[model samples]
Target: MQIQDLLKRTDKLPNVPDVVRELIQLLNDPNAKYSDIAARVSHDQTISLKVLRIVNSAYFGLARKISSIDEATVLLGMDRLKTLVIASGFASSVTKVDGIDLPEFWTESFRVAELSQWFAKRTESVDADEAFTIGIVHNIGRLLLHLTAPDVAHDIQTRVSNRQASRFKAEQDLLGFTSQDAGKALMDMWHFPKALGFAVQQHKRPFADGDPDPLACVLNLACYLNACIRTEREIDLVREGLPMAVIEAAGLSPSIVYELDDAMAVSDGLGHLIH
Candidate 1:
């Protein structure tokens, strides 16, 4: 089936809030004021409470607690405040879907997001917050597929697990499009930044073109690193196992992957925001 057909049956998917939609519009607006953003967030008590909860969480490691939306905006800065708002808002909208492990899914997504931000900071062309946001949303199409077609999703997963086909190949065979295709369609429907949608579409094959999109490259590396972490692979192996072209594409050194692995080790429990 086409991506549009699946999206047309999105009754089980999360309904993005109006405030979240407005916040997303402001996401790419260079002229957006922090005061206005704070006011908007404060107006939505649900999002406001979640933002405060996340900012005050141990993940941020702030010295003192923040009590107000204005203070949150000031402390987080516009970029990060925007990231938090988008993350919390989108995350809060998600309802339970069948045939998926919500906690496990979010845990991986959060790790990838943190790693994406880390890679973005080191890459000259990528925006760290944008990378983080994309990382969180990269797998949403898979979730959507699970919601709309659990039987097909299950078969695809089983095919990959049984070594019958790669996940992408299985998706292409079964659904006529990869999750990335569905994800980009969803992002377009949500009116997210075009670059963000492009990054999601290209992440699995960041170097498909002669010159890679830096955000896509960063996200690809983040997913790679996150996989290594999940499998508990040795740092030396991770460094050696990664392709030299992939490392260069993200403008990172092999040594930093070790550092990131150690950092990720201590970054547990941060995925609470997803629940």
Candidate 2:
């Protein structure tokens, strides 16, 4: 089916729960006061508990434990707090998708998100938090595909495994569209920033021509590198699409890309925070 058809099907798609959606809107609003956000978060006892648990986890490496949501907000800072809230909230919703194993997907997704944030910080392309958030949400399309068309998603996974084809190509061949297409459509339906939607859409094809957004290029490279390491599949087709201009724009090098694998090894401790 075409992406437009998928867009029309979004009403049937799973969404962030109402409370979580309101929290996201509040967090995204520039003029939102902390007291209002805190109150909203407080209203959801389960979510608040998860957020506190994550904050106190090894990821933050806090000198002392954070015992309350208010303390977490104070310690994590607004940017990190918002990221944790969004990540935790989304994780709860997305983990429930049937026919897909959540643990494996979470491992790869969290690794990509961590790596993307590291690259963004190293290259100074954007705030590390913003890059991390983008990295976490970038593949949300794949989750949607699994929800809407599990059979097609299985076919795509098989093609990716057996043929070593790029995820984008596998999805296109099997379903007449790609995760990026579906992801962009979902982002649009949710009224996400156009830049973020574009990043998700074009992440697999960074140098597709036009005014290239540097942030998208960063995420594109991060996703490419993550897939290269995690999947046994050879990805020459995916590699060839990485443009020299885009790499230059991000101020990254082959050496840096090679080092990312080792850097990720050190980040294993941070994975516990996402639980």
Candidate 3:
């Protein structure tokens, strides 16, 4: 459960393939050409098929069916196409864990992604697709923990269920680190953008002064809203001190937040989109 243990387990960490990594890099580039991006996506037939499937799925709400990677790129745009690829890669990669139920994990991930997209669209601070990707991968540290230290992962889950401790608090007590910390470390090593790495690292403590990036604040709000929807428990100390300043900055209200959660829960055919 120590940071050193996680560092040692890096070799065993699930990684996106080289092609997928290249695709991600292209997506992250601001000036990457559409034809070049399409070419990269089309090279991997499996990923190309998945891209087409997601584009035609309810998640995109496209008026026409997408039969090719080029058409999908045209319909979804570069950023959204990138997000879908990232989500598809992760979803396909983490289908099973020794101690984790894949379905339950994906259910929560889908909900979080949907809610994050909703909030992002409402706020306009970041793209909804980017928010969806962030929400889906925000807890990837938990997936990594299950692989590296199954016992510790079980202990953390038990505390969340029995003691009602927040997942972050539980991780801190049991593992001397939280999932956000682990996720940040892992993504940083993977060469993710600094803004995303910072968001994953500080999502639980969004309001702490001098956190320069506002995307972290948006991620924190998304996590809070996800937790609120999944559990009926009243807002505790952890929920109360979140960056309302950031929430206001994002142009969101408590009511709009609740509506987003509701819409995510009933997003038609969304259950089929995860796997």
Output the number of the lDDT-best candidate: 1
lDDT of each: 0.81, 0.70, 0.70
**Better structure of 1 and 3 per lDDT:** 1
Best model per TM-score: 1
TM-score, model 3 to reference:
0.81
Clash pairs, candidate 1, are: none
> What is the RMSD, in Å, between candidate 3 and the native fold over all Cα?
3.8
Q: Report the CA-based lDDT of candidate 3 relative to the real structure.
A: 0.70
Question: What tens-digit string does per-residue lDDT give for candidate 2 at 178-226?
Answer: 7888888887787766667788888777777676777788887777667
Question: Candidate 1: TM-score?
Answer: 0.91
Clashes of each: 0, 0, 0
lDDT of 1 by residue, 178-272 (tens): 99988899889988879988889898998776788778888898888889889998877877777667767777765665575554563535577
Question: Per-residue error at 274 for model 2, in Å?
Answer: 3.4
**True-structure lDDT of candidate 1:** 0.81
Local lDDT at 22 for model 2: 64
